[model samples]
Target: MDSGDILASLGVNGAAAAAHALSLPAEAYGNDAQLEVLWAMKAYNHAEVYFNLISSVEPTFLKLTKSDDMIYSKFREDFPDMDIKTLDPELLKSADAKEKWRPFCNQFEGIVEDFNYGTLLRLDCQKDYTEENTIFATRIQFFAIEIARNREGYNDVVHSARAKAKQQQDQC
Candidate 1:
């Protein structure tokens, strides 16, 4: 199926889930570091979904690389002083944006994790169909679902961030 089909399948709830996942604070949305983190998280999620879906159609495909390393590097560049050794759950929980999102962030993350790895892998290993078609369908579907879900949240974040950035720029 194409991206549209995937989105159509996800319906409104799926779209909401994606939006909630990508939503960021107005101040942080435009920060390169923040964008990198969000994109990295998004890419990782997409890769997982793609992998699972492909595996479902073809069980022999098992290749794992540090594809998400770029995103990590970006984060490091943006926040060089940040401690990388540990992830503080409290930090995520205490985040201003998270507070704004309330329980939605947790729910969104859960859904992304669930669909990304397992589903993609399962789809990849399917032995009953053509690999090329399946992969294409999976990619499109995943992309569409993600885009539809996150577009609104992404836009909101970006717009708010841009406005804040402009104010800061004027101050400078």
Candidate 2:
């Protein structure tokens, strides 16, 4: 979930050596207030950066993908019978999209990966992609809904906040 595990996985010997050199005396991590604070801060920072990055990238992807109708139509065309709640999440998550879902995968191309996929909350739970619900989904799913909002003009809710910040900066 974090860089430490990634470093360890990529090269155990190097990671071990680095940790040995940089780390303090061996000590087991305790489930204490300090540990909790560290985790909370890390999670919040990561999420804030990630959400903003996604928000900023929305325009570029919208330009690339074209119309909102095209995005949704492509979605429907790919999975005419999508009932994710009924299906097995593990099975669906690992199913190869390269061959079967080529169109969708092609849209994202090299940028997306299985690891980036995780649970996301949609704020407006009334509709499917209303930014009001959280569900476990792939990177493509995030793109689909976000692109849907971008093209359909629903993202002004997010954009307006940015505009306000810019306005404040300009005034200052």
lDDT of each: 0.37, 0.49
Instruction: Write model 2 residue lDDT over 1-172, tens digit each, in one string.
Output: 7655655564878656544533333245544674443434333444455456545554434443334465566765776665432333333455674346555756755444432333353444222332234444555665555555555556545555666777899999
TM-score of each: 0.22, 0.40
Candidate 1 local accuracy as lDDT?
A: 0.37
Instruction: Report how far residue 54 has shifted in candidate 2, in Å.
Output: 5.5
Q: Residue 64 in model 2: shift from native, Å?
A: 8.0
Q: Which runs of model 2 end up more than 4 angstroms from their true locations?
A: 1-50, 54-71, 76-112, 125-134
For every model in order, what is the number of clashing pairs?
33, 12
Query: Candidate 2, after superposition: displacement of residue 37 in Å?
Result: 14
Q: Which sections of candidate 1 miss by over 4 Å?
A: 1-21, 24-28, 58-172
